[model samples]
Target: MIAFFLQGLAIGIVSLIPGVSGMTVAVALGIYRRLIDSTKNFTKHWQSSLDFLLPFWAGVAIGIGLAVRLVAYGLTTFPFPTAMLFIGLLAGSIPLLLKQYWLATVGRKQLDRPLQLLILVISFCVALILALIQLNSPLSGLSMTFPTLWALFSLGVLSSVAFLIPGFSGSLLIMLLGFYALLTTRLMGFMHDILTNSLYIDWNSFFFVITFISGFIIGFIIFSHFVMAVVINYGQLTFASAFGVLLAAPLAIIVCTKALANLQGSISVVLVMSALLFLVVGFMTTYVLGLYSTEFTREHPHQGS
Candidate 1:
């Protein structure tokens, strides 16, 4: 349970990155299959699945609650280092994914198959296009109204779909839909108000929050089943596509964060070193975690599910 919570927290933290999918982190951590299996088969194994998922959900909530504020502040104050760190973490996970791929396809000629190759290219291109679109789009703040609330609910559903797809970021979709700023700002304000004065709350904002979360829960459950079916039927193809998307994520993050643009003019040696250091640290952290997760899974293959 503690392990699940920590892993969920890690996923939540990384999910803040524009192009980084939390599901991708689960994949890298060697728990993607277990997560899918448990979620999809919850009816058959409700007790065990609930025990496994409860802490994870709690951790996700805690991580997101903290990350929204911290990431907002970081983007405003220290965009470069912050972005570089996430980029490194995403990059580091790639090796672990490749190892998994190699293990799964060791005796098969799957990668050489034309259909698999096509799927990989198509997935990569689609993710690239989506990332570019998200990067170029402007985030217009939405006013709280019935229409906007419905839109937010719809966005939440779409975001859940993105969450299920490895390397597709739900937050990026929200940002593209022009509700990212409004959602984060309102959530922060709501949290502050609750902490400061719980009795005098804005019911309207509370309603919006509840509606969005409800949409996410519904969408997540539906999409989880769909994803589980895809994985079971086409494991290699699905993961191949996911691998392509993962490969594109670092580039997307760099583009979205404008990190390259910041470094283009009069690059300082100290700043460059600092960025490099942070990147390396992030990479090492995730890589080590990946190794640990791999070992843990091997030792307790059926412990969680």
Candidate 2:
């Protein structure tokens, strides 16, 4: 239980990274389906799976609470360096993601050249668009506005649902909704306020959190069901689309890097070195944890579905 909870904390922290998904880690770990199923049938598998999953979810919630603050502070204070680090993280993971897909389904030699080229082109275009969107948009100020809360709640639900779909990126969805930075900042502020006793418990803030979490639960069930149906009935197209998006994501991050307002000083060099180090760490961390999870799955193989 402790191990799984810690694993979830790791997964949650990684999910905060752009171009990455907690689901990717879950999939690599061989428990993606089990986690999805357990949550889907909470009433049925509550005793067996909930004990395992709940702790992990709690860990994830807590981790996200802390991470949101850190990520926000870094981005606001050191935008260029932070962006560079993320670029390293994204670049390192791209090959692993693509190669795994090809090896699992069609070997590299077996792919149709024309179709592959088409996918590559599509991926590039998608990446460019996503990058441009992030770069061009002004950072929205934090707000307690009802409309803003509704948007935040709506985006939270959408991003959460994306988690249930194998290749969908909740972070990307959050980016599109323009609440990625805002949510992180507000949550960070909310927590700091509570910890420092600077402000009373804000009912309005609490209300939105509850609303968003409820929406996330409802959305996850529905979206997971939708994705399952698609995977079962139209897996080829589904995978192709997912592959296209995954391939595009790193490109998106790279393009977004160009959108950065270059900072003063030789700091870019320092950022480059630091980012590389972090990428090595992130890659190796995922690889080792993934191996452990895989071994665990082999020992406790799932029963017939």
Best by lDDT: 1
lDDT of 1: 0.71
Instruction: Give the root-mean-square deviation of each candidate in angstroms.
Output: 4.2, 4.4
Against the true structure, candidate 2 has what lDDT?
A: 0.61
TM-score of each: 0.79, 0.78
All models: lDDT?
A: 0.71, 0.61
Q: Candidate 2: deviation at residue 178, Å? A: 2.0
Any idea how many clashes model 1 has? 0
- Residues 183-219 of candidate 1 have per-residue lDDT tens digits of 7777777787787987788776677677788888889
